[model samples]
Target: MERGTRTPGAFAGALILALLLGGLFPALLASGAGGTPAALAVCVLVLVGARLGWLIGIGERRLMEFSFWTFTYVFLGLAALVQFQTATFSTSTPWFDTAYNDDAMWAVLIGSSAAMLGIRLAARGPTADAPARTPLVDERRIHHLAALGLLLNLYYLIRVGPGTVLLTREELWAAQVARWPGNGLTAFVVAVFTLPLLVVFIGLLGVNRQRTDRGEPPRYALLAVVGCVLLFSVNPISSPRYYSGTVILSMAAALGAYATPWRVRASASAFLAGLTLLFPLADAFRRQGGVETRFAPLQALTSGDFDAVIQISNSVDIIARNGIEWGWQLLGVPLFWVPRDRWSEKPAATGSYIAEQMGYPFTNISSPLIAEFLINGGWPLLIVGMFGFGWWVRRRDDRMVQIGLLGGKPSGMDWILPFYLIILLRGSLLSAALQFSVLWAASWFIRGRRSAGSEGAAVPGRTGAHGGSILTHQTSG
Candidate 1:
């Protein structure tokens, strides 16, 4: 099917139906219970329903866009639902004490949906004129960079002590609290290195795929396989979900970029199924005594009973008690460069502050972009911020498409920012800013060296129809 072919009326109907089913089914199931369950269900439903609606409305044309929405809305929506049900089912000691009303929930859901839709509408049009294209850095340079990154990560792992990762769940948690540089710093470093490593790895995979497509020997195949295994093995064991999930999701997205639509759909379905079944097993790998059976594995995955939602809800409560920060929280992004010891006035990251407010000992929980915007300036800021975010994503994706980075073959250049885009979409402003800064610096260092001979090679392939090559790149998958 063509992109954006669904009619507005069809989209509206689908959205309405989704909202009704999402809200009504939960309410009906919980009718005899207290009102909180119903309220929580409504919030979960609306968020999820809106996401489905948007997906149906927009249709999937761009892999980055699809991945962004799926992660931000659909995945988070499911998590929210799981959290709500878990909270209501498991405890009477409200995780979030604020008034749980349908109005507030609807406001958040509708505002978010509107922002997404508005951005989509604004971004739709003919492709914009792109700037000059530069040849990608040579494979040898990419390999060298990959080797350097691998060595750095190895040094970091040794410095941190391999025992930290090898510990039992109880031991792991204890070590986590007492560990030097702390979880925040560790997470930051892991994120920073992972990006470039992924960039090189994906690039090599693309090159290898292109070579294979041309009936050439798969020279880099072994390197790609080994790199994949090493990257997966080196992930921080403490936070298995985020660390490992990021890598897995990124790889899937990279592959999806070069896949046919039907294949993308099938892969997505398989991924969701696998995630649901394996989530409990993965959670087991992080715990002290192996998996605790306090709740069923399926229950944990289905109820969104995970820590992320708890953090998000906790953030919402904190915002309700303390007024909005009016964007003061944003200073944490730029000021992150300064050490806290040197700059005592540096604002605490939103996640840390929310954790403190909730009296949680560990504060590494995620404060999603939605909660961040909500705490900054309420609905208006959220709507505007989301709109801007959508616009920016579109501009970036379009530019990449224009530069022949997307939609045909998988190239190393196409994977880097898109992987980061997934990260940015899910993280708070401070985290996003820090990660983006590192990625930008890495990109600068690893960027392709332009040579006169390579620059003129595109002349014969140029087409005036789209102001660039409308034909798929010869190197495309």
Candidate 2:
């Protein structure tokens, strides 16, 4: 009943706790067995760490509650893995072209995440739990925020104009809409990706009471997630590659569910997840055209197309595909030890390339530590640089933190606007950077002023606004 107290849900809490704490010894015990042994050991450690963090409640404030959602998310991720495995059904289409299946997988992921997040809400069992002190945004505030974001998106849209109209002509757009994996759909997806911020803004306004009281605004917020999935399904856009819309939607779904009581949020998450996934699955069924461009990157690289190679290189890196396809390019390269032509697909290319370049023969290391060691200096330098940068950012301002969490003022906005801003900035912006800066500054500011009584104190409105709440979420993917 006290603020921030959580009633444990399901067996997950205990199970996660045990695995996190107990998995480490066995993992370390198995080290030095062989080459693959090291990789397996590391996997065990990371999985255990993730579980432990969930148990110990690391990272965010409401981690336990979020942990349940995270657990479900991992399941959905497994479902996606299943979809990828069954991709044989759609394999011959082209380029491992499985847009439809990928969409279905993401839908399963999105739907499952939404459903799992809502579980606590579902487990009301007999009686509704007392309402938690969830933050309530006034309708006016939501509308205002939404309007601001929409305006920003429109401004950016006009600033950039339509990119290469040939890339988005109506006939081509319509055809691409019918079958998303088509080449002509690339620019359109990029354009649509920009819409989430706007949708978030508009959706926020619609979700709030004030606007709904006047006459319900259509449930536009739902559109943002769906639109993002569509864009991601297209699979060919270069800017904002990886179509993280589903990830963003997942974040929003988690927060939205958290903002309300468990049952309601759970039901809503289920419905929304289903709605978001529908189009992608449908797109897959219609994608008879199949994929042909799987080797587009290799083609470019071999032809000495530096620019194309660079672009494809980055793309492969984002999906964590190692330099497998670049074979001879990495011949004699340490990390590229596998084969001149074999691609090592995994996250953290920074480390992979470093190993090959340095002649270490690419093997996985724990966390981003390998990459950290390779870049900005080796491990020793990485520690200092990472910590120093983190500390520096933490000392900055709360605006940055707020921006990182829900956007500068995401209370009533969609993702499209901010996403557009992100694109324009070439993805250089770091929400984490902002959060660290603000936290540091707040700590220093509060510490300095504490002796001054009221002067040194948190302006009641700010300190713990996002903390000490049952429904608050501090970090998301």
Candidate 3:
């Protein structure tokens, strides 16, 4: 039954790949971008082939594994196609176009494709030095954490009012400027609202534990609380598509959406379709007072919606004029907690920095993972960085697969990292630094909370966050 269920999707995957490479590829070749047909072909094949490979079931098809391929294919691949076909670049700057334009396109294509190769390397790579995940749930500390979040979020809502949060993006920004108490804390405000996310999986842990062990009737009350608070605090009107998608997909994984291979392929397809067709439409209420754009996916791609490729192109342009930063710009990511007042010459977030360099009036554009690697040290860093990243991602995926084989459920960081990778992969590392730090910190806090409870009496979630065991994902309410 399971094998047959995958057949139709496999056929669908082949059909989609054919439509792209057979039909669209010919049209793109005839366009002005045909001037550099080789580069164009590599860009198209590398990008589209990634989606096809994953959909057809390559390697361990874990959720983060699916996400790595899907995000690359949609966010970078589609934009590369449009830019190559039209012979247009989104930078809108003559600043560094002095170099032939194919170079920028090439950098974007090469970096992304290289990362794909790196991901594949995981299969042949050595055993992980340490267990890939340490799943621990200190329900007590988590409740305290969630309580803290509720307090912070309620204070924000009361101060800014719920009306402000649900309003248009422009209005939300205005309210932040006018009402947010301090500088550099808006991300905190947003993070606070999504606090229920931390508890959802823990709730799922308890329920699933009971079901597997005792065969009791399932309870929906815990999940119900999670849903209510999440919706109240987050919505398309205010939260960016990525943030909302993260919360939604994480919740789904917690609900056991990736329990089977076919479901993995199915959801990956849904993600591809949604990102291509519905993502732009979802942005209609973003900055505008209300829905403004119709469901015009192609037009949205050509206009400005998918900026990952172009932003990577801009980073390339920066490299052309100024050379790679040689690991300087990236210094700020790990040290993101350090204030500019103290560091003085601390580099700005790459996206904003690149924007300022390009003289774009707006500084909030994307600077993708490819771009991030390119600007840091050009080809050397791009290859080493992406290969290492791909290897790491594979280790995590393998760990998840191991857990599934053992009939264990992940109820901690392992459950969330796949969703979190979405944010990390959509880079400008500084932009994601705070949230990343928060996750790491929370994992540590939970580990300590659990360890302190058992004292010298026991190890918490052994073999882990930074060692003793993967056999038990200790969860107690």
Candidate 4:
């Protein structure tokens, strides 16, 4: 593989390729009579195609462990495809009629293409000779963090009560839609609980990796398993399927970051297949009435496909109605620590605001990334924002590699950051910010222990320059 800067011609060619591929959306829309379903199908296809092209052309050099590539696959690729397919063929009707317009949809596709191209162009070239640091795992600190996490989990369970997770699917759905305002302290407690979980999760990953490397069974295996079960159980039992799936999937990505490429692929395929098969069944639980036993997973794919396209369309409508919020939507990120009740002027999450404008009962639904940016400041800001985002992701990747966290042996921060990409790319920047803050804090705390040892020692089984190991003895020991 070559390790040099990308030529200007190659960059231009890639940009051209993206534009041509993006044109497929408008062409498909025109051909399909400008129907909502057709527009959605085109969007999904373009998104998938753009992502695949990215992975093939640029991802290999960067190592596709937990980059924006994975984020695209989960949200833009899989989520969009399933929703489009389900809406097109399933017996269930869409949640609402979309105000589908060819012009708006085309703009979205164009913006998306520009975003993808911006990301590609901003990416740094290969750096095989870059200096690498060996990060030492502190088992003692990890154990302490895990214990703290357990306490937090227990506190949350107790505060919410076990009955919260024991509700029937119908009951759970009602609760979600109700959006009950609990005591003022409820939000505070929830935040406290969430912070520890992030720390504990990262700590467990570090401990597990160290134990495995030492040829010892994972010391925190039981704790990890229990934590996952509790984590998944708490959210999915009462909330949406995506919530629970996100927890499990991110955990899998973290744990499997160091696995063979084949293993990672196999695991991801199995996860997606399972999610597709079970999506309808989960929906049955969330349905307003009684439980739906006639689960048609294939048909369910089309069921409830209203969110993505409708939200994008709604966001466009919102900008026309009220003008661009001009970053007002992002105020929640900085003021996240302030409770909405106390801070009466706090802004809503972009997704929630869009949903509210659309008159939907559920404001917790998605607002696509492109739409969010467009609603902020139109195409110019969208392009700039996406390029900055891509640059940041690239920098994070480089940091991982420099810290000896890539190439089948990732440190805790490597696992934490990539797993959070799922949320970052999925939209609702405010929520992503809050979640990321906790994870970033955890990563900082658990990065590596400082020791009075030489940093030049080589890692076992891995060689660095001049026949020396890249990992220091302190890190290995």
Specify the poorest-scoring 10-residue window by lDDT in model 2: 304-313
lDDT of 4 by residue, 380-451 (tens): 777777666665665555544444432334555565555445555556777656656665665666666543
lDDT by residue (tens digit), candidate 1, 1-477: 233445566456556645654565445544333345335545555555555444433333345554555454433544444545444421212355535333334444655576566556646644454434434546666677777777766665566566665654445445544544565675576556456676666666655654665699867554665466455544445545544555555565665533543454455444444444555455555656555556454365443323444444565677678878888887788777777778878778777777678776655555667667777887788778877776666655565544444324434545555545555555556766775676556555555555333332333444655464532222110
TM values, all candidates: 0.74, 0.36, 0.81, 0.72
Give me the candidate number with maximum TM-score: 3
- lDDT head-to-head 2 vs 4, winner: 4
Provide the RMSD of all predictions against the true structure, rounded to 1 decimal: 6.0, 15.5, 6.3, 7.3
What's the ranking of the predictions by lDDT, best on top? 3, 1, 4, 2
As a whole number from 0 to 100, the lDDT of residue 106 in candidate 3 is 71
Off by over 4 Å in 4: 1-47, 53-100, 124-134, 169-188, 208-218, 221-235, 271-280, 287-290, 296-302, 397-408, 450-477
